[model samples]
Target chain A: MGYFLRVNILETILIYVVIPAAIFGVAALLTLVPGRAKSRPKYHSGDSWDYPAHWWSGDNPVAVGSIPDASNDVTFGGARGTW
Target chain B: MAHGEVVASTPLAADWQEPASGPLGDAALPLTAAQLELLDDVIFEAERITGLRYSVYLGDLGTDTRNMAEGLVKGLGADGPYTVLLAVSPGQKVVEVVTGAEAAQRVSDRSARLAVLSVVAACADGDISGALVNGVRMLADQAGTLPERTNW
Candidate 1:
């Protein structure tokens, strides 16, 4: 019957096309979401000096007499180089 | 129609922390006692030769390493002109050599660049302490004391 044929056509479309398309679309969307590919932090494992606190603070490793005063203007000169 | 069955299931596991003996721990301490002694000797000799206060700082500089280094140089007080501060942030792969105004007169920007290059080369070879010592020596040699009877 024509009715039976129509039902069969609709079922075929839903099972073979609609369901597969929906699944594929969901998989594509999941891949595009943020935080799925996180990056690791980079740190160097080498000999380095560890100051108790910021150098300006009182607990500097260098001698107190040798420490330079931050108030002086002469301390400001010099070129910065990056490696 | 056959019923849909759950064939397999995988549990989502939480992130785990690495043990101290792992790669992270192995890379924590970069210098040995011998290397530290070598650096101290080099610094002393460099200061004596250049008549400049040479200080070395090795650590992270947070976000703005230059500003932090400059601040450190400035904090050396009245000895500013005679001070040369070397700040190295291995994590960030940045090295800043700041010379006081007077120090810069002797150790020019070009000289500083050369020292930085030396440090970079050594660091590339996994010689952090050696790089510091070599760079300091180069800077000292470049900024050597003026002759006894020299008039500029």
Candidate 2:
């Protein structure tokens, strides 16, 4: 009975811990794919998960003749100065 | 009628809450007036459409989602009821959406992540405001604050 109980405890740990860890490991490995991969930042641990850059280049919602230059908005409004 | 007694006029001041300015009254969270203005616009537009306090920040932090999780704790300047931080860097396209303690309880990480992802996607497409608006919609949807029908 003692041996059976130990075996059950081991099984529980394997079921709850090991499996999830393995799944996460696999998921992390999958991140290396070209489109799926995250961008590398020097000295920063965080990776930039990229999407299609310049998703709306054609329409140009903010016209070139608008009050403020649309291109300036991208640099000033969105771009982070720190990074 | 020639008393020559002058009466002092008392001016009535309007009781209104003026928007606070400068570093948001917190040293830890550094932000400029322009940045605050942008965030205020986002919040105003978002609240008008979704009724949520949309706060954004720009700062450096750790890697992975963990950094954002940690940021959720220290996003806002003042210790308010709730705050959300959507940090973005165009050069790297690195974005992180961090929700405060109170906000975390109300907004799940997955949903918040989705919202951020949506915005990131939009930024990639070159629609900053559109991205933010879409992201706000996602958050509203997650919080069930979005209208039931598409009419609204």
Candidate 3:
């Protein structure tokens, strides 16, 4: 009985802990290895408002170049002034 | 594909896909034409690439960011399955971004801020749709890493 129990425990450790740890170890090692892709994302921007910088405002849909807000650095109303 | 076949209502039966006619196809979310346009131009565009629902609400809320924030949170909760909410109150020049609880737990404030910044930039550039889509895509990327909790 003791021999069987020991074998079961050993198999559990090997199957669960040892295999998972080995896989993680390989992944960690590979992570340290560098890759060739250094370019930023397609639309990556340090500043969020790098595109069109004007929005509509007022009853007549007048254009507003920029509206600063505490929450958002740049805020915009819709072109039709609906937003 | 088979057509003109009278079908019986059975548990084993599957429904056929119908073309969209008016506002949207049946089974699609009930939304206003304007809202649907926004979803199509902004949300749908972002979701196509990232597979996340991004909602935007433009309306007024009296002074107080906390109230606005709370209202936004409630609004997003009511909206169903939405990961993010970008609310704008033109009267107050207040912009509040309320992420769903799941998104909040997963997506960091910095990522949300970055998305907000992109929207602001887009407003500056006169491309509301572009800014919203880009921002939502970023938010979706941030939320994608989280393990989805099952509703059932």
Candidate 4:
């Protein structure tokens, strides 16, 4: 006769109720990733933008850094306009 | 190399390469990946068609937009005289087309102005990618139609 009798009511609640509740709470918290991804902002005119400057060339595109201020400002005449 | 192969009328896969290193290491772009890729393709195609280096600078153009734009074109260094630069300052709501001496010979001031106008109109409608593509295409088309260089 092999006896395995251990069924405390509080122990049962801790194993079946408390542990699962903690696990479920943690799992629910971890699943909030999509909400973060969905928050990538889109640009519209008049909206204050905070993106860094970028320079694109077909051959040598550069993710620009502290651009030098144009000195002696010569008008290299091309075309200028506003939206 | 422009005439080396059959060119597609629409943008195919552009050789959009990322710089190996930068100050802003892989920062998220305001535009989506697809938007950046499309701009890349348009620039590549424009360069191929006209044999003129086409570059774009997007962000603030400072208080004096023209001076900032002109400086950027000059920043192209040795390729300066052969590049056509479209510098757009969206937050400031201004756009500039700066063509170097060699490129200016092919794309006139009037034509560049017209292209800038198209860009501004598109930007006004809040279509940043469309604005750039339209400007680049118009400039390329104008320069590509020369009878002597039917390199296409």
Cα lDDT computed for each candidate against the true fold: 0.66, 0.46, 0.48, 0.76
Classify candidate 3 by CAPRI docking class. Answer: incorrect
> Among these predicted structures, which one has the highest TM-score?
4
**Global local distance difference test of model 1:** 0.66
Write model 4 residue lDDT over A31-67, tens digit each, in one string: 9756644567656777766788888988833212122
Candidate 1 regions exceeding 4 Å error are A1-83, B1-29, B146-152
Q: Which sections of candidate 2 miss by over 4 Å? A: A1-83, B1-42, B45-52, B58-81, B146-152
* TM-score (C-alpha, index-matched) for candidate 2: 0.38
Q: With candidate 4 superimposed using the best TM-score fit, by how many Å does residue B64's alpha carbon deviate from the native? A: 1.9
Stretches of candidate 3 exceeding 4 Å from the true structure: A1-83, B1-38, B45-53, B76-82, B145-152
For residue B16, give model 2's deviation from the true position in Å: 32
lDDT of 3 by residue, B1-152 (tens): 38986666775655865644544432222233453455456555444433334566544545675455555445433222234566544334445666544345445677777767766776555454465556556666766532232221
Which has the higher TM-score value, candidate number 1 or candidate number 2? 1
* Residue B12, candidate 1: alpha-carbon lDDT: 50
Q: Per-residue lDDT of B30-140 in model 4, one digit per residue for the tens?
A: 666677789899988777656677888889988888888878888877566667898888888889999876677678899999999899888888888898888888988
Give the distance in Å from residue B6's predicted Cα in candidate 3 to where it truly belongs: 39
lDDT of 2 by residue, B14-76 (tens): 576645653334222233344335545555544444333455433333455445434443433
DockQ values per model: 0.11, 0.01, 0.01, 0.23
- Sliding window of 10 residues with minimal summed lDDT for model 1 chain A: A54-63
Interface RMSD of 4: 7.3
Predicted complex 3: DockQ: 0.01
Q: Which pairs in model 3 have colliding backbones?
A: A49-B121, A52-B124, A52-B125, A52-B126, A53-B124, A53-B125, A54-B124, A54-B125
List, residue by residue over B1-152, the lDDT tens digit for candidate 1: 35884544674565786764533422234554566668878887766555677888777777888888887877776566666777777767788888876677678888898888888877766667777789888888888754541332
